[model samples]
Target: MSAIASEVLISRLADWGVDTVFGIPGDGINGIMEGLRRNADRVKFVLVHHEEAAAFMATAYAKATGRIGVCLATSGPGGIHLANGLYDAKLDHAPVLAITGMQETSVLGTGYQQEVHLDRLYEDVSVYDQMVVNPAQLPALVDIAIRTAYARRGVAHLTVPNDIQVAEAGEQPYQLVAPAKPPATAPVYLPPPVRPRDSDVRVAADVLNAGGRTAILAGIGARGAGRLVEQLAVALDAPIIKTLSGKMVVGDDSPYTTGGIGLLGTGPSEELVEEIDTLVMLGTNFPYTKHLPEPGKVKVVQVEIEPTRAGLRLPTEVPLIGDVGATLEALLPLVTPRAERPLLERYQAKMRDWREKMAALENPERDPIAPQYLASLLDRLATDDAILTCDSGTIATWAARHWHIRGGREFYLSGNLATMAPALPYAIAVQHAYPDRQVIAYPGDGGFAMLMAEFHTAARYHLPIKVVINNNNSLGQILWEQMVLGYPEHGVRFGNPHPDYAAWARGCGGFGVHVTKAGDLETALREAFARPGPALVDVAVDPNEPPMPGKVKYEQAKHFAEAFLRGQPHKASIATTLFKDKIAQLKES
Candidate 1:
């Protein structure tokens, strides 16, 4: 008997080195499910509670491993559920393939139950979107889809009809021309890393050498170029400011590093950006143009692998189009090292002062639990090589400011997408990818509640993931935004009766710990980390603790005052908590 098309598809995926798939099974996809079962030894299918979680898992897997991550779902609602996660992958430029099932080809246009126009639905999010109409088309379609996804570094989608999947491989008719040979089998090909032109590199180097004080803004594109960046910074005597997505690329211990820049940036980094004459950007397209120094004030040189991304955020004096590591290797030899070291020293001193100020704020004496203290404690306790995932919100801000990257640690987040609820799925994927390494997820209350069912997914897989919940019981980031914008916090508040996430984790067959006091946080974290399976540690933190901007503009201060005068409930408390320690420093200044 000949193999079914679905079986052939699964075998091809295994050939492409896809050992694991994340998805839920449905009747519409029974043929594909059988294929998975038949190939169970080669490829494993993880059963997630929701299709959305499966998509998120795939995105996380792709982000963690620089390979194509696959996710499957049945037609209609199951396919619809995948949109959010797929969007996450699309925006973040993670390579992923979404295989969604469809009704029989005959029923596709006849208004049948569970029928969705998945091809049209996924078109916006996918780089390659196609539906297999015949059994013979399966192999070629699957091959193209996977290759396109990998080459484009984005989402590829295939909607396989149930009828076509179960059909025999050789049963379908093929169109052949008389006296013509069969088409040659296409070989698997991977895209090579791009290299910048020598002239472009020389121009960028010249821009850097011409400036007295240069600053290097590194992003995720610079992941493998850490040593090169460090060398370049040393040669130029420059301060290195990392974008949030590229925080782990350079270790915090590096003498030239001034930490993250922009909204969740350090004072030293923000000041350095303002004073630098030359700004060299690597691999990051940081969206906040306002946070960057005015274009005319600073000469900009950007290096990126993707041609379109170069100079998209800010005006570039020299756009070096190439892989970050390769471009830096070429540029380093051309640039003249700066002789003066005063600017670098000034920034380093400011960085030290900023760290000391943050240390003071991380005190355990705060009445309501200080998130900074918890983040710092986690940073201290987490393994040196641990992988950390953070959700979008105040927890992200806390992690950005407090989680010290000491070289080996890996951090993942929804960079361009900035989506919420990715922490759990990302942790799950990371744990699955590197079972021996410690994996941690930090999600705020709102983000955690979005995909709370994934706790069961973790237990089912027996994934040993540590999920630390920043339980502020409010959409802390949004609330802060509202206050800064002069709007009263109306819908931002989460009314009492917040679900106990730790208890929910236990209910899902995982260990759980709830810590209400700051003193007990470390103990609870230690206990949770010791669990053999997944564990959740819910720590109650102050909801009013704002993630203050690096530079508070006059408009922001005016709006904040307006909100306070309008009788915002927590305004006074939040204000005192934010500025009390800074008053003495302000007086001295």
Candidate 2:
């Protein structure tokens, strides 16, 4: 609503169980701010400095609480800032209602001051986007947008024109409709797929029966099928490997879980992929295909609820197109259970070995620091129920690998969009939205540098978000990419002019610490997490570390090999040749 006319909308917002909104109020929303004044007691508003942070904060709150996350902004520039953030929410299936103030409805096309078509601008990212130019249309439109956001499980934008917001309304009280939500344990259904008993299921069961070594790779589709996978694993004595996206589907404690495979994966699954006699894939489309052994070694049987994904990647030996849970339930009866193999025991032993090795890697006694060590220390000291939010880039790689998930902690990240600078906002949202849960945000130097100013916002609200800044002074992941690609590592550097992130946090009335070496790192992290309000722990790390389990495309590798074989060592640059020991000797240089 315009600064002059936000009464009814604000009143109705409180009715919708919107206690706290994430946003930085501006001129376009001046009217709404006035309306918000009336709702001070009923609603608590968190005024963030950046619209992107606001959007993400709302998204985090909504995701954690399973409520409609609300963010408000003014039209034109303010609304434009929401593009990247809205995309994150959309991809994550988060329910976010974006309320933006627009120019007067009369001067919209006339290009009046701060005039831009936000409704259209937001259309692509939002499942529902509309301009409420009429005051009378609001009660219904307001109700509809919220409903669409809830049902669609994505972002919805409502652009309220200034004039309409300021216009007089009917004296009737507007009631916000509560969105219906299914309980967490609700049974999800899939369309009945014609899995012929003789053709598909029977064939898949036969493959499982014949295979001496079987492994089931479950994706997000296998979410509700954890128990089924457990039961099936017991029947076949097969281990389960999950994609990063499907991490929560099956608990890590399950004997079937051998850890994730592909990029950012760890544990025995890395080598287990080659040994599998049959790969039974569930509801996943892992991007890397070459990582799979030749089609001959590992026969693939895939079950997917979505029919389109049945034979998506490697052509499936048997495509059982059915709900993941239902398909496993049906197939279990047909297959004969098998005894655990010696190799299975070896694989389990490797998992235990790697976990111990991982702990040592984090608390390494070396002089040159490892970022994984810092993360592990943070992991140990952080709140038991802390919501760990991570940014994309090198820090993301470390967090995904080393940060173990316990029952108390849940992860927050932009899995699809993979945008940076979401860490600060997600941290704010997690703490503000789920005050009960301990929350921490892991941001790379580049990532944290982007939204460093938000520390003031954190201080303003005294939001209890602990930020772990992996300060390598560069986009470490890209640096690794440059090296591995045989390209000269350049343009990824962030020099001394970089903001003293920890100092800035202190300046902003929050806790701050700077650690430059590997020693005493755990103590610093423990102290940071122990602080009451917001805290920033800046730990410098070696940029030369390799991003684990990364692959080289056949085409790219062939081209590079041809170049290198033709005597282009100079052309390969320092990065390409030093993939393994990037920190070797160069540290002395």
Candidate 3:
């Protein structure tokens, strides 16, 4: 029996182990919707409120599972809305497949209604961008798209015309002029174990062995190789500074770790980056050159899967171009173990002091609840195996510093893109992926308000995802950036009052709790976690409280003072809040 191209496409994805697809139904792509209806048992369609959220959900799935996340959208506006989220996947190196619809081929280039050339639109962001004009192209095109997405660790886009979607396909695959066989019969492309050459490994080992004070910078690329990284750290007696993407690579509980680097980093990490003479970068291309040591001052050893990224960030004495785990495994045997790690011990002590300093801010007695307290409380209340995601804002800083990853917990954020409004969608996708696991979201008021409708998606699906909103009613991060850049805070605050998010959650058929007082915060969180269905807790936090950097630069302090002097709004309140924070720290000391 002949099958429609849409069915063929859906079937191909199912065969490749795609169990769920995130998208919304539209008339432009009715045929694909019908295909989904037919294959309901094999491939489940998760209906999202918007195409942007759908793409975000797909990216989240890819990040959490390392599988090719698929999102569907209709032509024109629908496809256009997907750009933001697809870029998120592209920038973060998540393998994602985006399928968008196009107008019927009969219209050609007649400026047909919603006749968007999706292939051209996606060219910049996609690894493989193509439009299907023939039914016979599915078997090869789908395979190649998926394969390229995996190979490049980026997005692949396929646009099917309205007519082409329902076209009957022949049993035989399209013949393409290529050196290799048709991809239809090609087994799923799984990345093979890649290790660096013996000479390169030896060179890297030599650099590490000769260093006086060494440090390891691990990124998302170091994920799944946690044990190997930890072993390497112990062998070298080096401190591990994680990029935000790699926060879970080694738990903050580990003595060797000094948490993160850059603006959202810990005090110990800042010191470690500046003081270390030798730096070993593992599977991370951390871009903050200012936070990194001066190039010629520190000898560098970098291991990367992509050869192009090896020396992209800094000059490298040894560039081990291979998979992080395999390269580290090969190098570990050659590395000489260090006996007395006075530098490592010193940083460990600093890490303890930093933790204490951070912990002191988690005060429950504060009138307007501190964001730090909320983050710390969430850390304590959340399950050991919970999956946590936070929006890109001051919320990220709080999550990075306060939430310590322990047990089987995994954390994700916008990372490189630093985009907002991803946490809720990420939570929904993760909850859908692991129905039994606890999935939580931490988004600020500004971000949550962007894609607030997605809460209904969770409610409609009856996902037991928990959302914790740090209701500060301002663009906290950008506001601070302006102050630090000597500009008065302008158009940063959300006017008047913010919506009652708890009421919105309840309206969407989910559990809701609004906590305005510090004493009520813990009870609301406990209630949200205990809910059987989707729940949201909107906790009012101090808007004036700044997310201070680990090591405040001299220029930053000077600029902040200038901003305050030059008619910054709410300057007195901000000054008072800053003073209270310092007083609390002094009392703790």
lDDT of model number 2: 0.74
Ranking by lDDT: 3, 1, 2
- How do the residues 35-54 of candidate 1 rate in per-residue lDDT, one tens digit apiece? 99889999999988888888
- Which ten residues in a row are the worst by lDDT in model 3? 178-187
For residue 566, model 3's alpha carbon misses the true position, in angstroms, by 0.4
Best by lDDT: 3
- Residue pairs with colliding backbones in model 1 are none
How accurate locally, in lDDT, is each candidate? 0.87, 0.74, 0.91
* Sort order, TM-score high to low: 3, 1, 2
Q: 158-242 in candidate 2: lDDT tens per residue?
A: 8887766666753222444953332222112223453434568888988888888878887766766788887877777777887
Which residues of candidate 2, in runs, are more than 4 Å off? Answer: 1-8, 11-16, 170-213, 219-229, 251-254, 274-346, 550-589
lDDT of 3 by residue, 1-589 (tens): 4578889889889988899999987877998998888789999999999999999999999999999999999999999999999999999999999999999888969998887798998999999999988777777788889989999999999998888888885333345575334345552787756888999999899999999889999999999898999888888889999999999998889888999999999988998888889999999988888888898999999999988888888899999988888998899999999987787789899988888889889989887899999999999999999999999999999999999899899999987889989999999999999999999999999999999999999999999999999989899999999999999999899878668899999999999988989999989899889999999999999999899999998999999999999999799889888888888888877
| Model 3 stretches astray by more than 4 angstroms | 171-184
TM-score of each: 0.96, 0.81, 0.97
- Which portions of model 1 show Cα errors greater than 4 Å? 173-187, 579-589
